[model samples]
Target: MLHKLELIDIKTHKITKIEFKKGLNVLHGDNGTGKSSVLEMIGFVLFDFLPENQADYVRETHSDKPEYGKVRVWITDIKGEPYIIERTVGKPGVIVKDALTKSRIPEIRGVNQLKAWIGRNILPMHEIELGKLFDSSIGIPQGTFINPFLRREGDRKAYFDPIMQLGVYEKVFKNLNELNKKFEPDVQGVSETIHEIIGEIKIKEELLQEQESLNAEIISLAKKLTKSESKSKGLKEKYKEIKKIKEQIDEAQKKLDELNIKSEKENENLIDMDSQLRDANTAKQICDETKEAYNKHIKLSSNLEILEQEFEKLNAYKEDLRINNENYIKESTHLKQLEEVLKKAETNKKKLPKLERIYQEHSELVNKIKEIEATIVEINAKEEQQVKLEEKASNISKNIKSLKETLVELPELVKKYNIMKDIELRIKEHEIDVANLTNQLEFFKNNQEKINQHKCPFVDQTCKNLGEGTFNEDIFNNKIKTKEISLQDIEKQIEKEKEEIHEKEIFREKMDILEKDKTTIENYKAQYRDYQDEIKALKEEVRIKPQVIKDKKE
Candidate 1:
């Protein structure tokens, strides 16, 4: 059996020393002292129990606060040999020492090292008949776990029988008889073997208990499996219902897709109609612009013709002036010749002054003759110039009258060209516009039947209840609106838009009629201007008179 225990620096104590004696050593100390801790350390150092109480004296009172503590214990071995087991906190690990010399042992230097060392030296108290083999308060035995190894064979036999007689596993007859009394006290099986030992019978009963425990575990596991299978079946049924609902949703989606395709076809037709209408309007506008430009060009050409007539009249007046200039040149030549005669007369009058009155009178008569001759020459030249000027003036007047008549005709030609072109282009444009509008109107009319036949109803659900049916609109409207717009409101708005567009089309038609009437009036005005110009030019030509001149001497 084991002997003394000594504690140093172990739990709840700092540097406290304790000692124990052999056989029964009871330790008593106040709470928070090292008494129980000393018992725990001895049990660990000797029999490998109470590992947590190994030898650390310090621990963290709270996780946030820690105390570093160390512990060492002295225990006696089976032959009364002493050894020290030492432990410290804050990283230096376990240490085991020779008790007498206080020198450390190498093998017992880890946290679990002490457990292995003790297991080599000690038998657990429960495995032995601990109460009979060792003391209760302190576990040192009288003839304990150590004694079996130390004693002689005869001594060992004595220890074994006494312990065997007291334990749950004893001889067969004793155990069987005990069970028999408990189960059937007054009855005994006859002719059966009675040689079974009590210890063997007791072993058989232990086997039966083990089988009973195993059977109970099997039953519990089977019940759990059955519950799990039922739950699996219920979940499968729910999955099947969910699959059916998905199929219904898919069918609804396919129907909605067909409706959408029909609606798209209708929309395409409507779009084509709208595009055609816009193209027709554009063509009409282009034609009207072209006609207006042609009319403007015609007006400009008429103004150019009038300007040419005025230029021709100015040219004729220049020609008459040239003829009068020839008359002026002849008159100048006659005046020079008359001046020479008068100078000769003056000279003769100066030389014959001695002849008196006759010479002077003759000189005066010559001077008069010269002056009269100069006057006659001037008059004849004037007459000649007037005749040539009158002839030129008549030619100029004839040319002016001819030009006026041609100019009047030009205005009529320009007006006629403009009116005809305007009327022809306008008629062509109106025909094209009418064709386009008719095609567009026909397209819309043809598609309207298909659009009405295949309209899809929009469906929704308002609540999560299983029995509730889907919600939908009764009357379908083909137009798509913004998310915030109500469907019923859009249906009403569509009718109003249709009426407004129809009114615009009617107004366009009336404007086309007015344009045709304006073109006709313009043509009439051009023709009237041409006739008036021709009549006025003819009258001016008739009203002109010819020039005349009388003969004269030079």
Candidate 2:
């Protein structure tokens, strides 16, 4: 029974695996989706079959040529004995492996051998009978897949027997006999992988959020630019306002600069505004000379002038300090008050040294406090830097995780690339052999009679395969057959190599991307280390905070 199908680099399929269940297995898709191709792969893996050129089985790719296309199928006989059937294009042999142990069975090394062995072991038929039986039935006519099953008995068997060998193998073989292979892909350390995957998802979400925020900022900035342009005139006016000075102050300053009080000529300009503003003596002289009203007509000038003369006489008693002192002093009270004042002065003098000491201590305390405050400010600044470093490290951790995953894949790709290179070398060797043999074969046919017996028809200076048998008519025919087969195999290998190499090249291109990120990961690591160093320093500062406060209190 057909159990599972695996295809690699086969026509339109790159890498795909399909598991068959208890019921119907449907290949449903549009045209050129490789629906029929899947059926072909299953049949090929089972019977070691190729309906067309083997080169066509390998996938077409854009990067470099591939060396092989592969197909694998798991099946079992009526006894529930499990086996794996494996086939590869660009390589020889049909490998039938034990499904349990994955070791090759010694028999069935070739296509005919595989069919013969399958007939003998699993069914009661010869290779030719098996071929005849399957040839008409296994093609899987498109659109009529289920129609044959809808028909009765013999008609249904024609379409279905080739797939499962159900006619003689009974229900167990029809059910694919407990090989029951299911494709369940899992990673080692799956829990850790899940955590990492979750972390990556979170990081990606954060980045998306940040991108949205930046887009918002861009929109906001554009709006601000428009608003700023509209208010340009107001801003310009405010900027101009900065340079303005009060004209009144400026005028007064200018007047002060021109003021020259040393000469009467300068005074003439000063009196030009207020002529009635006279010198005091000059006004007094005028008042004494004419006993008239001060500003306008008034007749009491004589009495007021006598009173002003008496007020002026008080300045004559300025030298009578003895009498002033005697009037100020009381004999009993003066000496006692002076003694009390002296004692208080002595007391204040005695307290001055203590006050100075207290002042000094306070100054030192204030300075120590200021120093602690400065240390605190510095610690805060570094702590902010530490926070920024952590955020940056977080971003790099995400990057490093991604790069490491890629790195894990690089070694496998490189291994494949090396294998492809070896295949290319092999292809070249085969091509050279084919070219030389082709030249010899062409020469031998053209100049057959000119060469003597056993002198070598193609060689004797023309063909250089020295120890090889002479090119007689029989040998010639055999060579032709050998050449045709060799050419076919070489052609298939070359075409398949081209496709496989392209795929390997695609994987190699990722090595370039990986190398680029390799440097980036290194830089990130260096930066992360620096962040750790700075954070550690900040932590040390934080640790000192309590001690600093304790010292400050003391």
Predicted structure 2: clash tally: 14
Report how far off residue 181 is in candidate 2 (Å). 55
Using lDDT as the measure, the top candidate is: 2
Scanning candidate 1 in windows of ten residues, the lowest lDDT window is 545-554
Off by over 4 Å in 2: 1-344, 448-485, 515-523
Per-residue error for 465 in candidate 1, Å, reads 37
lDDT of 1 by residue, 274-317 (tens): 99999999988987879988789999999999999999999999
Q: What do the candidate models score in CA lDDT, each in turn?
A: 0.55, 0.70
Q: Put down candidate 2 lDDT per residue, 416-439, tens digits, no spaces.
A: 866765565455456545544554
lDDT of 1 at 14: 42
